[model samples]
Target: DAGVTQSPTHLIKTRGQQVTLRCSPKSGHDTVSWYQQALGQGPQFIFQYYEEEERQRGNFPDRFSGHQFPNYSSELNVNALLLGDSALYLCASTAGGKGHAPAKNIQYFGAGTRLSVL
Candidate 1:
């Protein structure tokens, strides 16, 4: 398995629209992280989920939301999107355990979903 996979490799939307992206984590991974990467920029953290709950979040607005299922798959939802929201949405998976520091957990990334908003 490729560790992580995302659906709708490419998507197109207009301003004020909403979008949903899906992700499936690798086997044995219990944590999921979402990121946004703009052209010529590094991936920006959006949030992290563990045990079907949001554990950490970045400096994004409430329009960005996500949910994790018991199976560890996740979906990221962006509402009322703007042109600036056009970017690559990335999904990463890692293992979570007692005494395991977040920074120490190795994250495996998916190819990412490219979103274009006009």
Candidate 2:
């Protein structure tokens, strides 16, 4: 079975351009979250979506947005991108619900898309 997958593993854009990143969750995963990782920095949560609704969001600006489909796949869209936006965009997937192992509750990340804004 294929695990989580992301498309166009790398992207480039001008400071004012926009970009879209895609992700398909792992088998049986019901939750998807987006994260941004700057060079040499740990991943920072962007937002999370469950049951097709945004369940939580991080400190990112309005330029960072996401959508989850009924099938649990998700997309991240950034508009009016800035040069500082250059970084790795990560997508994480995990099964939903409680009663799972604390360790099992951790999100599994995809290889991530490296975005470069010039």
Candidate 3:
């Protein structure tokens, strides 16, 4: 079975442009989450989706939006992009089953799509 997959491993864009990144969830995963990782910085959670609906969101602005398909695949869209938006866009997937173990619910991130905003 395939792990999480992301398209356009790398992306380049100018300020104010928009971009969309895609991801395929891991086998049997029902939850998809997105993160932004800047160079020398840890990833910041963007949002998470389950059952084709957004379940939770982080501190990102409204410009950062996402969608999840019935198949559990997902897409992250950034609008009116800013230079600071440049970073590695990571896609994570997990079953999120009922469990008390944090480790068990852990989301695994993929190689990520590097975005460069000029």
List candidate 2 stretches off by more than 4 Å. 98-104
lDDT value, residue 3 of candidate 1: 74
Q: Write the per-residue lDDT of candidate 2 for residues 26-114, one digit (tens) a residue.
A: 88888999999999999999999999889999999999888999888999999999999999999999886534877547788899999
- Model 2 sits at a Cα RMSD from the real structure of 1.3
Q: How do all models score by TM-score?
A: 0.93, 0.94, 0.94
lDDT of each: 0.93, 0.90, 0.92
- Model 2 residue 116 lDDT? 96
Tens digits of per-residue lDDT for model 1 on 26-49? 777888999999999999999999
lDDT of 3 by residue, 1-118 (tens): 9999999999999999999999998888888999999999999999999898999999999999999998889999999999999999999998874345675478988899999999
Better of 1 and 2 by TM-score: 2
Off by over 4 Å in 1: 98-104
Q: lDDT for model 1, please.
A: 0.93
